[model samples]
Target: TGACLEKKRAHDREIHLHEQVEKNYARLQELEGQRDGLTYMIVHDLRTPLCSLISGLQTLPAMGELGADQCEVLEIALAGGETLLGMVNSLLDVEKMESGAMKLDYTLLDASELITCAISQVSDLVLAGDLTLVRALDSDLPFFEGDEDKLRRTLVNLLGNAIKFTPAGGTITAAAHAGEDKQSLIFSVSDTGEGIPEEDFERIFDKFGQVSSRQGGRLMSTGLGLTFCKLAVEAHGGKISASNAPGQGSTLSFNVPIKPVQTIAV
Candidate 1:
């Protein structure tokens, strides 16, 4: 009886040790997950400082005379830096929007002007892509209330994608008109590049959603660009949508009321 009692005690001890080991293993997994998340956050936050560095580097060329080759190298570096900064800012902006930390500076403005400004920012991109630009903004379009800066960014994002996706010799159109109700303005950026698949229509607007370059196939997508557009439009109490026509191309558009429900004078 004594020997049997001793064996039972030994078995209980082994079971306790096994349970403790499992608990420690789970805790280690949790810590590793936290570490990964922290690392991702650190990498994203690094963009702001890098952008500032690139901006500083950009001024160096203008500050002093340099050899033509040196200047060219500096320019190339600056351009790449600017692109990196853009991605970082895009990711940070997504975080801000998701956390409800963004506030719009709404004002009464001409919406077409926003479109034109957006096109101007990407004019070089269009030229680089060897794509033709077609502008058909309605002349009689009425003024609308919106955040000019946000709307400008939205147009830039759409036009940028259009330019990236459209092939050489293809055309991109920036068109706007009055909505069916005549109380809202509708804007679209259509590109004759690799069009989006029908199944991705809804998913494209999601956070970190599937986004491909105009070159097609899946590239590394932070998915913040279109998500930013959707949020900006909704902030104005507007709706955004996406669609692709058969063998034509893809069109991304948004509609905002002629007068936003809430507006402030600038």
Candidate 2:
């Protein structure tokens, strides 16, 4: 009878420990949610001032005939401000998407028009980097229903990522084609840059995940670009991925259903 009583006490202690573990886990999740809310508020507040700064910088060029040096300096400052604003907006959008608060603004989109517009937006940067921008889109890309602005931003983000790692004289190609099933369209951005390590293929999509460049050191970025791209694609009922080229560089691709069967609450 004493041995049986000792066994019962041991079982009670195990149950207590399990209950404590569950409580701790729940508290950890609650703390994380509060931290995320705080961060979102801070980032949201930053957008207003950033926009005003960028607007002031934009007006300076048209206000008067600026000297060559002044114009160059203004351009650089404006670019930086715009980039920061983009990062802030991305952080907010990512939060909304993760919380299932963001809704898709679906519309009929022309594949060629979408690709062309995205390329045009980044063409100046591509040219400044001494990089070649190639278009490998299929001729028969059909009209698709999706959020036009978000999809364009996704392509731009992918192309921008390519431009960041690609060396001078390297090539960055933007390609689009229908999937074999004809139910979706696949878009890819491939760059002839330092290839990604096989280990980082998935991690790169995580928030704030950065990878070291083979050129020398760690690549500088907010690292939310790919995360935004991933969320945007998945919200369209699609999938995104990264892969290495045979000899060098890497490709980032995503497929959006031609007719989305369901909306992702992500």
Alpha-carbon local distance difference test for all models: 0.82, 0.92
Model 1 spans with C-alpha error above 4 angstroms: 1-48, 211-222, 262-266
* Candidate number of the best TM-score: 2
lDDT tens readout by residue for model 1, 139-244: 8988877789888998998888788678899999999999999989999999887788777777887767766544536653425678888888887888999898
Displacement of the residue 86 alpha carbon in candidate 2, Å:
0.3
Top of the candidates by lDDT: 2
Backbone clashes (count) for model 2: 0
Model 2 ranges with Cα > 4 A deviation: 215-222
Poorest stretch of ten by lDDT in candidate 1: 213-222
TM-scores of the models, in the order given: 0.78, 0.95
lDDT of 1 at 91: 69
Per-residue error at 102 for model 1, in Å? 1.1
